[model samples]
Structures are given as C-alpha cells and as structure tokens.
Target: MDVDDGRTARARPSSWAAVAIGTVAVIWLAFWVLKAVFDVVALLFAGVLLAVFLHGIAGWLSRRAHLPAGWALAVTVAAIVAVLGAGVWLIAPSLAAQVDELSQRLPEAARRVADHIERYAWGRRLVERLSEAQGLPQARQALLGATRLLSTTLGALTGVIVVLFVGLFLAAEPAAYRRGLLRLVPIARRARAATVLDDTGHILRRWMLGKFCSMAAVGVLTWIGLSLLGIRLALALALLAATLTFIPYLGPVLALLPAALLGLLQGPAMAGYVIALYLGIQLVESYLLTPLIQRSTVALPPGLILAMQVLLGALTGGLGVVLATPLLAALVVLVKRVYVEDVLGDATVDQGEGAPLPGLPEQR
Candidate 1:
C-alpha cells in the first residue's frame, strides 16, 4: 500500500507536466490561427463600425421623425442609397476621366522629378543611392507588381461587399446581436459587458460622424484650393486628399506625395505653392475643423493614434492602418471603462468627452 501511494504521488507531477505542455501547445496553435484570420477579423470590425454608423442615423431618425426603429432604419438606408446613386451618376464620368488623367500623368511627373533631381550633384547621388537600394527592378517586374496590386484591389472590393452586408444585418437588429454576444459573458459580468458595448458604439458613431464631416470639408476645400492654384487634375487630387485624410498623420503625408510630384512637373515655385496649400489646409483642419466637429467624440492622443497606425500597418497592411484609429479609440474606451474604473476601482478616470452617451439623457 505504501509503494502504491508512492507511485501515485510520483505520477501526479508527470500528469501536471503533460497538462501544462498541452495547454501551451493549444495556446501556440490558437495564436497562429488567429494571426492567419486577422484580416477577416479586421474586415468584420470594419463592418461593426459601419453598423454603428447606421444605427446612429437610424436612431436619430427614429427620435426626430417618431418612426419605428425598423422603419427609420429602412428610410435611412434608402435615403443613403438614393443620395449615393445620384451623386455617382452626376460625378462618375468626370471623376473617372480625372483619375485616368492623373494616373497617366504621374509617370511623366515622376520622370520629370528624377530629371530635376539629377541636375544637382547631391540630389543625383541621392537618387542613385535610392535606385541601388531599391534594386532597380525590370519593367516586367513592375508590371507583375501592378497586376498583383490589381488582384488585391479586387479582393478588397469583395471584402467591402461582405462588410456592407454584415453592417446592414447588424444594424437591423443590434439588440439581438448584443444579447447574443452578452450570452458568452459570465452572468455577473454581462451587465458590464453590455455597458462597454454601448459606450464603444456611442464613441465610434460620434467619431464616424465627425470624420465624414471632416472628409467632406477637406475634399471641397482641396478642390477649391487646387482650382484656384490652377493645378491639373483638381478633382482627382481633391478626392485623393479627402480619402487619405481618413487616416491621420501618415495619410496627409502620402496624399501630399502625388500632389507634390505633379507640382514638380509644373515648376519649383508651383511645387512650393502646392506644399504650402496642403500644409495650410491641414492646419485649418487640425485646429479649427477637427476641434469643432469632433467636440462630441473622445480626444484621442495623436501620438498614440500614429503609433497604432505604424504598428498595425506593419502587422496587417493597409486595412490595419485604415482601421487603426477606430480600433485604438475602442481600446481606449475598454481600458477606461473596464480596467481603470471597474477593475482598478477608480471612477475618476474620464469616460469620454463632449456629449453624454447616445440615447441617454444628458447629465446635469
């Protein structure tokens, strides 16, 4: 009996070691699986953002028009579709022409830039070093890269369609989805999870509203500014600026590159003017417009957002970069609400700025 007891005791440690190894193997597998599916997860998160936007609009309509939630959502969707269809019908031809022109002009513009830089000894050396570093791939390689990019874009379009459908379905019955999600949480923590979800949604909706307003303002202002400066492809440049502005710091810099390249094709003075124009517009947008528009949204730190952009971009490519800001915003809300307030027992942390939580009465 003593020998048997001794044997059992010796077996217990080995069993625990085996259990530990199994747990670690499972975790390692999960990590890789999640990494593989990260892109799909990012796309779904994008859909959730869209759903939040739709819910915000639908909620506003429900409140103002006194329509039922479902009817309000239907109206909102129909109105959006009609507006988009009308806008596309009106602008598609001209925008397409401008885009084609811009694309065709860009290569020439780049060549002109190279010629200009080569005129200077230091600039010539710099260009040579850059070409050497890039390995100066053959035309066939460039063509292949372009073909790959085209295929990627097509894949992205498919993803967008999926996101749109997902968003619509989510927006249609958010409460049902919410309940479904809450079911996964412990019963004791379910209320907190629901609150977190609501807070995150409110923050995201406000951010989107502000962002769209800023994008529209930037597009219009850019078109006007470019037209005043007599830049070719004003429409295309404006559209690019507006779309890129959806990203924060790095985006503005990227948007400037093509514009500057085109400007360089015109002249050095024109390039200077274009640079100044973009900087001025950015200053206005950063200081005046964003403050006014995003007053109701959380004041995210620019450095943090930029860091997230860089990290996510490295990890997940362009989609990661695009969604980084919203993801960061959501993370901030979760940290503030869940970690700081609840876990740490500190309610002094500011939950959000600007307006109160959406669909709730304003606190005195």
Candidate 2:
C-alpha cells in the first residue's frame, strides 16, 4: 500500500507540472495566433453574426407570415436584393448630380474657405504663428502627405467583395453550417454549442433589426429636413446618413460634414439650417428613435468599438472596421451563453449589462 501510494503521488505531481507547462504554452500560442490572425477570425465572427441575424429574420417571417421556413428564407433574400436595388435606383440620379455640382464648386469653395480662414481671428493667429515658427511650408507638405496616406489603403476592393460574399453565403444556410460546427465538438460540449448558437442568433437579430429601424428613422428625418431647407441632393444626403448610420458614433458625424458643406454652397443661412437639421435629427435619434428601436443592446462601449476598429482595420483593412461590432457581439453572446450559462453556472437573472449590448435579440 505504501509503495502504491508513493507511486500515485509522484505521478500526480508530474502530471500537474506537465499540465501547468502545457497551459502556459497554450496561452502564449493563443496570444500570437490571435495577433497574427485576428482579421480572419474577426471575419468569421462577422459571418456568424450575419448568419444569426438572417436566421432570426427568416424565423420571424416564417412565424408571423405563417410561411414555410424555406419560403421565408427566399422572401428574405429577395427583400435584401430588392432593397439594395431600389436604393441604388432611388439615389443614383441625385448622387450623380451632387457629384457633378461638387466637382464644379469644390475649387471655388476651397478658395472661399481659405479667405474665410484668413479672416477668422483664430485662423489668422494660426497663420501668423505658422509663419513665425517656420511651420507653414512644413504644414503644407504634411497636409499633402496626409491626403496621400488617407487615399491609399492596403486592401479595399477585395475585402468588400469578400464581406459581401461571406454575408450572402452565411445567410443562405446558417443552420446547416452551425449544426456542422457543433457536430465537430465533443458530445459533452454539443449542448453548450447549441445554446451559444441560440444566444448568438438572438443578439444579432435584435441588433441588426433595431439599428435598421433607427437608421430608417434617421434617414426619413434627414430627407424631410433637408428638403424643407431647400438643400440640393436631399435624397442623396439622407441616403448617405442612413447608410452611414450602420457605422455608429462616427456615422452621424460624417453625415454632418456633407450636409454642412452643401449648406455652405447653398448659402450661409442654409448652412445653419443644415447644421440645425442634423442636430435635430441627432436629438430625435438620441431621444426618440434610438430609445424606441435600440432599447435592447447599446453595443460595446466606444473605447472597445474604437479599439476593435483600429485592430480590425489594421488587419483586414476597412472590412474589419465595418464588421467589428457585429463580430464583438457574436463573441460576447457565445462566451456568455456557453461559458457563463452552461459551464460555470446558469445565467444570473441579475446579470450585469444583461447581454453586454443594447440591441441583443429577444430570447423568443
């Protein structure tokens, strides 16, 4: 008995030491692997998000419309294509006109802007300081360099095609793909994977639907307001706002730029109207629309969004930036449902942040 116990104890210690070493090695390997391949991983997560969201819509349509799931899927796909085609048809004329007008007016606008800058007190002080500090020449060169840098990206065209294809394929047969994945996992983990898939579907659908609703509201408001203000290309700017609204934080800010610029071209008073229009839109979005539509998930915090944007942008270029939040939401849902709910314990009713976002899909 003594010999057997001694041998068992010795073996246990050795096993524990080996396990510790293996754990550290795994951590190191995972760190490097994630660093090296975050873009591909991020894209995969984005795929999962798209799949979940589409499936949710399919399910909803199937339920509410009392159609077969397959037929609902077909309708959903048709709706997506129709929306895209209609948007293109609707905005093409206004966009082309706006582009031509901007092309003609940009030089005059630039000259006027320079003159206005030279007249402004802060602008005059900046000019004087730059001249005194011998910064003007360097600043001009730096401005050109910055413009060049902004114009060039590592990968853009290819990434857009990839995202489009990924989103399309994922939406087509998400259940089959998900089931195949869960089957690959151990039998013990299969249930957990199922729950994760369910949770993910819920979160993604809520997010996409809620955001779309809010964006539509914003677009309608923008279109109506700009039309009222006598702005050129009101439809175009409104469409831009709706499209950019998918981006979060930076989106509305970007919408303001073209609106203000167009307003400036129209007249100083019109510029005020444009700014006021966007501001009013922003107010409505924050106070009314978002509250009504986006009451579920708030998305990840701005800092995390910015960090993911920078990271994904660095890795997969702009596609990563665009899909970052959806990707993050998918990850959070998977982790929460599988780890916190399945492995660690049942999900707490008093869970902090509930689902860590405002637009998480309903459990139903």
Candidate 3:
C-alpha cells in the first residue's frame, strides 16, 4: 500500500509538469503563428466574406432565373465583373479629376478653417499652442495618417488578387468545402456543425443584402442632397460614404469629415445643411432602412458591432474594421447555438415573430 501510494504521488507531479510544459508550448506557438500569419488569416476571412456574397447572388440567380446552379454561378460572376467594369468606365475619369481637385482644395480649406478659428482669441491661442508644439511635424503626421486611412485595407494589390481568387474558389464549390468542414467535426457533431454553417450563410446573405441596399440608398441620397446644396465633390463624397457604409457606424463618421470640411469651405449655412443632411440620412437608416431589412436578418447590437470594429481595427487595421460586424454576428450565432441553447437549454428569442434560430432550416 505504501509503494502504491508513493507511485501515485510521483506520477501525479510528473503528469502535472508535463501538462504545464505542453500548455506553455501551445501558447508560445499560438502567439508565433498569429504574428507570422495574421495578414494571411485576415485575407482568408475577407475571401470568405466575398464567397458568401457571391454564393448569395448565385443562389438567387438559380432560383429566380430558372438556371442551373453552375450557369447561375457563372452568370453571377460575369454580371459582377461587367457591372464593376461599367462603373469604372463611367466614373473613373470624373472621380480621378474630382480627387485631384479635392487634393488641391483640401489644403486651402484647411487654411480657411484655421483662419476662421484664428478669428476668435481662444482659437488663436489654441492655434498658437498647436503651432508651438512642432506644427510642421504634426501637420506631416496628420497627412500621413490621412493617406494611410484612404489607402486602408486595399493597400496590397497582391493580397487583393489572392483574396479574389480564393473567394471565387470558395464560391464555386461551397458545398464541397462545407462538407469538408463538416468532416473535421466529430461524427456525432457533424450535423450540428452543418446547421451552424448554414445559419451563418443565411445570416451573412441577409446582412450583405441589407448592407448593399443601405450603402446604395445612402450614396444616392448624399449625392442628390450635396448637389442640391451646391457642395463640391458631391459624387466623390457620396462614393466615399457608400463605400464606408460597409464598415457600419464608424464608416459614416469617417466619410463625414471630408464632406464637412468641404462644406465648411462653402459657408457656415452650407456646413449646417451638410451636417443636417448626414443626420437625416442616418436617422432614416436607423429608423427605416435597418429595421425593414433586418426584419429577416439577425439584429446585431450597435454597441457590440462598434466594440468589435475598434478591437479588430486595432489588430488588423482597415480590413479588420470592414469585417468586424460579420465576425461578431457569426460569433453571436455560435454562442447562442452552442452555449445558450445547448448548454443552458434555453430558447433564444429572435427579432422577428416566428423567426427560426440560427442553424435551423426555414420551413417553406
């Protein structure tokens, strides 16, 4: 009995030591891996988002156009390419010229703003303090920051190309890939995994549709409003707003700065109008557009989305910000499905009446 007890005591210490070593090793490896492949991983996620978008379009074409799945996929790809090409053809020259004009006007606008500020004594003191605080360097830093932001996640052409092809491959054989993913799960849990995946796809599709519509509505409205108010670079500002709409709350604010700056150059009245216009558009989106579209989609909390955006943006820069909401949405679905439903044995409520839980197939 003494020998047996001694053996047990010895075995326990060694086992614990081995486990501690393994845990440390795993953590070190994970940190290394993340550091080495962060950008690649981000690109992969971006590809997945693109794949989801393409798959949604392909599915719609198959159902509505009465086309074979393969044909529908092809048609969707071709249509996207054609539309993009047409947009570039139609808008590139004008956009380029406006961008150049804006570049020239921006410095002048800054000077005008600075002068307006200098008119007030407190503003002059603030300006003087700012100037004393390495003014040239600060201005240079500001310019660099702006450049970085404008460049954003689309900085690497090669990365963009890789993501595009990856998306195409994923969209082309999503079922095959999905099946492959299911195979990774234990046999008992494959069905559950499949359900989760399908639910993710459904939510992603709904989000994409709503997002695109929102962007389009915002862009069109901004352009019309800005043009009516005689704002210069209306098209550019509108395009910027539309593109940034993909980023949720933060995007609109970023887009607003340049528009507001341009409006300031016009006059105080025009600037006020610009601000009111932006607020009105946001109000409509919040009250009308979002609710109408999200009726069939998962309603993500704005605070949660904003938090994810900040976290992801800090980690992955522009790409992370763009993808934050979708990632959060997927995480929410998984948590609700796995933790809330499975672990807690509680039914989660949906935003809409009779809305099925994620991972549940909708009844026709």
Candidate 4:
C-alpha cells in the first residue's frame, strides 16, 4: 500500500507538469492567433466608432424632428453622404493641384534643409550621421518599406469600405446587435453587461463629438494662419493638419513636419513664424477648445494616450496608432466599470454622463 501511494504521488506530479506545459502552449498559440486577428478587430472597432457617430446624430434628429429612429438614421446617413460628396466635388481639383505642387516642392525643400544644416558644424555632424545611416542597404530597405506601405494603403481602402458597410448595418439596428452581444453573457450578468455597453457607447459618442469639433477648429485655424503667413499649399497643409489631429500627440508633430519644411523653403524667419503659429494653435486647441467641448466627457490623461499610441504603433503600425485613442477610451470604461467597480468594490467612481445609448435605458 505504501508503494502504491508513492507511485500515485509521482504520477500526480507528472500530470501536473503536463498540464502546465499544455497551458503555456495554449497561451502561446492564443497570443499568435490574437496578433493575426488584431488588425481585423481594430477595423471592426473603427466601424463601431462610426456607428456611434451615426447613431448619435440620428438620436438628436429623432428627438428634434419627431422622426422614427429608422427614418432619422436614414436622413442622417443621407445628409452626411451629401455633405461629403458636395465637399469633394467642390474642393477635389484645387486640393489635388495643391497636393501635387506640395509633393514636387518637398524634395527641393528637403535639399534646402540639408544645405542649411551643412552651414553649422553641429548640423554638419548631424547630416553626416544621417547620411551614414542611409547606406545602400538602408536605401534598399526604404524602397521595400515604401512598396509595403503602398500595399497597406490599398488594403486600408478596402478596409474602409468594409467599415462603412459595417457602420451602416450597426447603426441601422443597434438594438438587435446589442441584444445579440448580451446574449453571449450569462443570464445573471447580462444586465450588468448591458449597462457597461451603454456606458461605453455614451462615452465614445461624446469623444467623437469633441474630436469633430476640435478637428474643424484646427483645420479652419490652420488654413487662416497659413494663408496669412503666405505659405504655399496652405489648403493642403490645413487638410493634412486637420486629418492628423485625429491621432493626438504624434499626429501634430507629423503634420508640423511638412508645414515646417515648406516654411523652410521660404526662409528661416518664415519657418520660425510657421512653428510659432502651429504651437499657438495647438495651445488653444489643447487648453481652450478641448476643455470647453469635452467638459462633460471623461478626460484621458495625455501621458497615457501618448504611451498607448507608441505601443500600439510599434505593434500594429498606422491603423493601430489611428485607433489607439478610442480603443484606450473604451478600455478605460471597461476597466472602470468591470474591474474597478465590480471586482474591487469601488462603486463611487464617477462615470461621466452623456447621450443615452440608442436602445439602452438611461441609468440615473
């Protein structure tokens, strides 16, 4: 009996070791699987954000115009399409011309920059280091990278079409989708899940509203400022600035690069003035516009947002960086509602109020 007992103990340890190995293997496989699907998941999340925007507008139209939800949503979509189509039709030619000019001028601008840098001893050293970095192999790698980027851009265009369709479908029947999602949860926890979903949607909607307002303000201000500065391709630069403003910290820096390069083409004084204009615009947007617009929304810490952008950009490239802020915002909501309040028993955390989710009851 003692011998049998010893044998059983030894067997148990082997079994436990096997289990641990299996668990580790499963985790490694899951990680790879998730990495593979991460881009698809990000695209779906982008569609969700678009849906939120559409639904929010439809809700407002429903309330104000006394229209049925479906009709309101249809009107909202039509209006958006019309506005976009009209804007494109009106501005595409001029914008295209400016974009072409900007592209042609940028190479010259870069050369001018290199010449200026060669003037100072420290700048010469910097240029030498840069040149050294851009060896034959590095140049080959850059060509390959550009090729990959072009392919990725094509893929992204397809993804945008998918996102648009997904958004339209989701906005059309938000309740059905919400119910389907909740059905995945256990009956006992489904109510809580619904609440969390509603809160997340509300928060996302507010963020979108604030972001649109900020983008418009930045675009208009940039165009005005660049025009006054006599900067060539002001329209293209303004458009670029407005679009990049969607990505937060890294975006502004990127937008500034082209504008600054263009300014450098003009002269050192113009470059300085261009830099000051961008800085002033950023200041006003960060301090004044955002605070007033997003007062009722949850304020994300700038540091956290920047960190997330860097991490995601490294992991998943441009799409990751573009979607990082909204993804982080949704994550914050989930952590607060699910982990902090539910798991940690800290129910006092204030979840900022916003527009009620299209099909969810308002939580008082």
lDDT of each: 0.90, 0.76, 0.86, 0.91
TM-score, prediction 3: 0.81
Q: Model 3 segments beyond 4 Å from truth?
A: 1-36, 119-155, 351-364
Tens digits of lDDT, candidate 3, 137-209 = 7788899889987776556887789899999999999989998898899999888888888988888788888
The residue ranges of model 2 lying beyond 4 angstroms of the native Cα positions read 1-36, 42-46, 64-68, 120-157, 297-299, 314-317, 339-346, 349-364
TM-score of 4: 0.84
**Candidate 4 wrong stretches, greater than 4 Å:** 1-31, 120-150, 351-364
- TM-score each candidate: 0.84, 0.71, 0.81, 0.84
Given candidate 4, what's the lDDT at residue 155?
Answer: 96
**Backbone clashes under 3 angstroms, per model:** 0, 9, 0, 0
- Candidate 4 has which clashing residue pairs, if any? none
Q: Per-residue CA lDDT of candidate 2, range 138-227, in tens?
A: 889899888877655434455455666787677776777788888899998788678767666777788888888888888998989888
Q: Candidate 1's residue-wise lDDT over 125-234, tens digit each?
A: 99989888778568877998999999999998999998999999999999999999999999999989999989999989999999998989889988999899999999
Q: Return the lDDT, model 3, position 51.
A: 92
**lDDT-superior candidate, 2 or 4:** 4
Displacement of residue 231 (Cα, Å) in model 2 is 1.7
lDDT of 1 at 335: 95
Error of 2 at 38 (Å): 3.9
